[model samples]
Target: MEVSSQHLLSNEYTEVYRRLPLKLQLAYGVGHVLNDVCASMWFTYLLVFFHLVLQFNNWQAGFMLLVGQVADAVSTPFVGFHSDQSDNFWLCRYGRRKTWHLIGTVCVLVTFPFIFSPCIGCSGSHQWAQIFYYCVFISIFQFGWASVQISHLSLIPELTPNEHDRTKLTAIRYCFTVVSNLLVYVITWGILHISSGEESKIGPGDAPKFQHVVWTGLSLGILCSVIFHVFVKEEGALGSSDVRGTSLRTPIADILRSVEVYQVAVVYMSTRLFVNLSQVFIPLYLHETLDMAASALALIPLIMFIGSFVTSMTIEKLNRCFGRRLSYILGVLMGLAACIWIKWGSGDQFKSSQIHIIAVLIGAGGSITLVTSLGITADLIGDKTSSGAFVYGIMSFTDKLANGIAVVIIQDLHKDPSNTGYYRDVLTYVCGGSALLGALAVISFLKKVRGDPLGYENVPNYNSINSDVLPVATEDIQPSLIS
Candidate 1:
């Protein structure tokens, strides 16, 4: 009797494991902390580093990250494919995902340092040479992240089939992510100490300051990799007869044919795009345009995630009372409102309080959308025949492609030089418009979800965060039982 994911929400399945063991949840979730913190170090600071430190223009800097996202998007499917098919010594010894995790962590450590503090042909003359240098470095760094991250994600399903247990672990992971994000805020933006005029004199960025970011990424990766590999375990990953999802159908065709699945992808894409845009710019808005010190900059992510933590509880209740659609609509509206403030309220001096309010609103909105969307995706894949891996691959692809395109648009749109100023109008309209579009998607999502064949509408009662946007429903899922 293969239980569908929809069954997991019911009482019979939910209590199979009321909560995962403390040790397992902690180890698995902390792995997420490592992945997120390292990635955050890049997202939060890399653009600023490129513009300020590497002498890359706004487009050049944006191009590097966009390229990185491209590489990450391209490699992720291969990673899933290879993870399933590979018969390497590591797969034999350490299990499928663990082998890649170790390999990926090592690559992350090696490539991460080069991103912020590169030694590649310090040629001051050829702009192409530097562009090529950062592009390769950034792409490889992002690829390594995908390698480890995709495997980390696959573990959530494999670790336990109990919905309650898996949800708890997901919550734990998000909490750790909040902490990791704050840690980077402290390490990077929190410590920046330049006076108002110093930004122009040292354009590329401060080497020692960015080196802290690199070292922090490396150390966290090492520690979390050790904890995750040593303490966490996987089943049916390698050398297991019960391994699922060996489908050969055209994955793109499968996803495209399903309107609900495709709409869920849109919601996922829109949310990731808006958040990545915010991540890339908030530092610029704070450190550059507002002329805030490092310490003032550090508190933003903290305030934001804390707001998320505070409001995450009520989001689910809102969903239960008002439905995921209305809850999501409310979240988007809050984000749009915040963008309104950013567009108009931005001044020469940093209004830390006002921005903090914006952060809280965006954070809360993000939390609500994130929670409901995953529930929707999960409902889609809980079927017995669908390729959960393939659907997940599409979702990851959507996230990266949308994020890359959004960043490029922002960077190219506001190609202002360093120390000049952020084009707040450009930034605000773009972000606000993106949020407005997301709200529209949520409305469509609610319409699509109105009559789910698998009773998905009744199942989204989450009290915590879930990182995996990928799940399964009976009608939408058809697991590969043949292989």
Candidate 2:
């Protein structure tokens, strides 16, 4: 006898998996890999690239990074606002998100050549010219990055309505991200080795070598973008005809009017500020204080990759056993501990190997912080609104903005070239303090929602008259299946 309908509902979930389109499945798997590789490559290695390859001073390098991040911050929100306003924007022949993805791919292809171009005939005052070139190229690169990142992230919740499926999907995406992180670390190390002769000595003038490496990376990035565009499918559309026709001004007003949006935005901004400050300083600490080789510096990302891989594999279990809020809190606390260790511990006591071990532990904590916080942002948006694209755009903007401010603040703080030791000490204190403060803020927010499992109070009803004002909910929204 065939199973009854109720029995099938109760016993089978594999059917749901089978129902997903082949294109979606492939895109889901590949997108994360491509995004992680491309995104991390710039942030993780660019500092060293500028310092060693470009021969820029620490302050100068930091400022350049600051500029790129600031540009990212400004551009992301505008993009988000525009995206929310447009209907079938990505749906014109090519998929909705796919069109932007292709555009970003082309942008990367065009920009990579500039990044790798040699310092030939660049003498006298043209030193500034070289710096200007690098900065502009990086800024443009980030613009393309933000476009692809915001659009792609916005696609996630729309692809599936099921809360459980979203979590599962995010986990899968993170797993690929880990793999990409690892691949880039290995590849970057190899490229530097081949191009530099000595890992520590490569500077800005080796344009030919840098160009070769960047071209290869850019080609790979373009190929991945194409795969993503061709395979990824956006499943849902904005429900209301009015919403579809809504001017960009409407969503912008709506986003601005929402209080929860600002609250989430503040949290994202503060957290990113704290975390990235620490991240930016890590290479500086390794290079100046630890006097480590570039090859050794690569271990930082390698360790982070491993930690992310482990987290990706076990996130479901962690979320199930400990509620998402607690899991998130734990991750933040872990980051706090790592920061404290690096800040207060005696550096001279540890050998190079021991230092690397410490770096790994720190990396593990940082990995946890990154993955959990990002998941929380998605959940926060999900609990509050059905408009996934708009929410994701807000989150992305907050993160990038925070990064921009943090880079500028840290760079400005470390402006004195004469005091290397003092600079390191200051970086340690700032990073440690920021991490602790960020954790506290997150904890405070979580405390408000401790009793409310669904956090429904956090969601504001747009139809209400006072809806023009975003409200802070009395109860924190519970991290739940809906989020």
Candidate 3:
């Protein structure tokens, strides 16, 4: 009996992996890498580019980012809703979610070059022109990114039904994401170091170097998209053909009516708020407190990548051992401690010896918090009644909202350059406070979700009818035929 049980478990594992085509798995992994590379590089360095290279004031730079995130907040959920409703969209050809993916890819390709283009002329009026250009391009980029990100996230549950497999797959994707972040750090730092011939360059007229870096990123984005499209095969839609139109009012009503979804969204938003707020301050902290050069600042992402990579590799084991809720609490507490240490204990000292150690601690703790939270999101989605697209859309929207709010708050708080000490203190307070709140929310939600295991019994299964071989019902096809 023991041997038979073991054999059955092994077979289940094999079947889980086999559910996704090998090419699709590779494409998914590669797509994550590309996505993070673009996102991390731009987000981490864009403020610096605007402030140091383009000569924008810190508030202006922060506000631009704030605007972009606001745009993301508005667009993500709307797109997800539309995509979820579109029955004949491209992804339906194979019953897979490929239509939105392809559309998102094309949008990225189109917007990428414009993102890199130098908007300001070399003449006297360049500064204002550059600002105008930055705002436009950044908005466009964010819009396109929202479409891609929401659709990509929505695809996760569709890709696999097994909970354990989903966890493993998520880990693999995060690993690739970390690697991409590391590469961006190394490459961009090298470029900045080489171009400036100094530790950091200041002023607005230095547009050429900035343009080159943006172009390089654009090129990489193009290559990554191509690779993803070539390898990934999205699964067609599953189950019954009752094409019921999802009521637009339902999502809003769900938001108001479902206590569970509201609680989850709040936790998600609070956690994101804490993380993003802290991230915005890292560069400033490095610059002011540690006196680190721009090249060294690049090491921030590298450290974060390493931490995220390690945590992702062992996430399943960690989840199994600690349980997701307790794990998140532990991670958030650790991250909070690190932030406090850096802010109160070490901010004034500015020692090179302490910098690396602090970076590692922050990175490790941040990674654990991020991964555990994402895992919880997957769990929540699995438990919910909504479609995969809608769940991800809601999550994405909440995150963007948090980010937008964080940017505005941080920007307003940090308007005065002379009061660096106060700024640091405020950041510490805000970030630490939010983390604490998120931990509390996680604890509460854990009580509600404690007994559930990842499974698909709750979801409708369409595979029994051989989704791939079934002919798509067209307008001309008789409804009677399908019945």
Candidate 4:
């Protein structure tokens, strides 16, 4: 009887951790399309909508973004914590992560359109009322966004244990993200071009263009998510055990105490600050500093996404060849060069062609940095699937909070929206400075990981992994989880 039981257990273990099928990977990759599309609008267009179409000043626009970020930051841990415990919830029988994903998806689809739509029952004279109205919806939208983001990201660690597979998954997921961003920019460019006038500045008349963009994004996101839920399936809650024969659920206290955790977290956070802040300011730079037509807003970003799409497609091979840290530094340097060009080479003349090249650099740099940072994060998580959501939650907390505070500070620097010079300087410094800092953080992270530069030594052997279901107590998980 004992021999038979061991044989059955061994078979189960092999089945759970086996290489993921191509279809499963593709499904998992598409799962984030909802968040990606909405986020493209949120980061790229939120400020533009508030400041331009709704007539909020720069401060007010930045404040709205801050509100959403705070909400997202606050909600992330709760959703992550609860998601890790989804096995206990009856409603999560379909899947703990998917249940939260469904809830978040519903919240986003319902509230997101209203965010870009007219502030019903409030006119331009009632500025505070409109602000309050937006605050409510933005808060809800942000919370939902966090839920989707945390759950989806946490799924990466849960789905596979192979480092190469994890890298592939992360790379594939990013490709879909790039595609989502491309779709949104295309939709926005087409709508703005067809609907709006020849004027460079976006005005109240362009409100409907934004509405069309959000709805189209929401609709496409819905379809992708449906395919995700249908094709992707979660195994049993305890998950495949590590080769060390330990439980998948490492204690939260253990995770928090690891130096490696903080290392990857910093890299992840700095990368996000670089990507998001640059995205927020890019449109404003084009419209205000370059004095390009409104179409430039979508066209420039469209070009950038094209560059990112190409990078995402090829990054897996680059990562295999160059290693994570070197690849990340390469991306950072590219972004820094773009920032330098923006600050000096562009000059006062509206040289549209040169700016498009700069856009490509930004996009390519952003793709490599984001993918490698996330790949490093998955390496950090390894087989600790239970706390994966919490780890991601904490990382996102720092990213969103820092980004919010940064935006508020940057926007506060120039109270007047028409003051393009200060804003221009701000963009160059924030984006360039962040990329440099992120590169430094990556270098620092390697030193902290002891002899394991790639941090792959922490991962257990996949072939011998067992799923015996031994959940460790906090006191039992030693600090050596990192070393």
Candidate 2, residues 1-483, lDDT tens digits: the string is 332355444532322212345456556666644546656656665666677766667667777777777777766765555544436454435555555655655665567466545544663446678788777877787777766776666565445433344555677766766677677776666766655554464456554554554555556655666677666654343211221233122334665676556555665665565555655666666666666566655566566567667766777556555655566566666656666566555546653455555555555555555555555556554533335456667776777766766665665676566655643564456655655655665566655643445322222222243322222221222232222
lDDT of each: 0.63, 0.57, 0.61, 0.81
Model 3 bad stretches (over 4 Å) = 1-23, 86-96, 121-130, 201-206, 236-252, 347-350, 383-386, 452-483
- Per-residue CA lDDT of model 1 for 331-401, tens digit only, reads 78887887887777855443746778888877777666665565445445443122444555566788887
Model 3: per-residue lDDT, tens digit, 163-237?
444565676676777777777777766766776555674346556655665666657766777787666655442
Per-residue CA lDDT of model 4 for 265-284, tens digit only, reads 78888899988988888998
Worst 10 residues of 4 by lDDT: 470-479
Which residue runs does candidate 4 get wrong by more than 4 Å? 1-17, 197-199, 236-240, 244-246, 347-350, 416-418, 450-483
Q: Which pairs of residues clash in candidate 2, taking residues 3 or more apart in a chain or in different chains?
A: 52-203, 53-203, 53-204, 90-96, 258-470, 259-470, 455-477, 455-478
Best model number under TM-score: 4
Supply candidate 3's per-residue lDDT for 312: 67
Choose the strongest candidate by lDDT. 4
* Clash number for each model: 23, 8, 8, 0
Per-residue error (Å), model 2, residue 274: 4.8
**The CA-based lDDT of model 2 is what?**
0.57
RMSD of each candidate? 6.2, 8.1, 7.5, 5.6
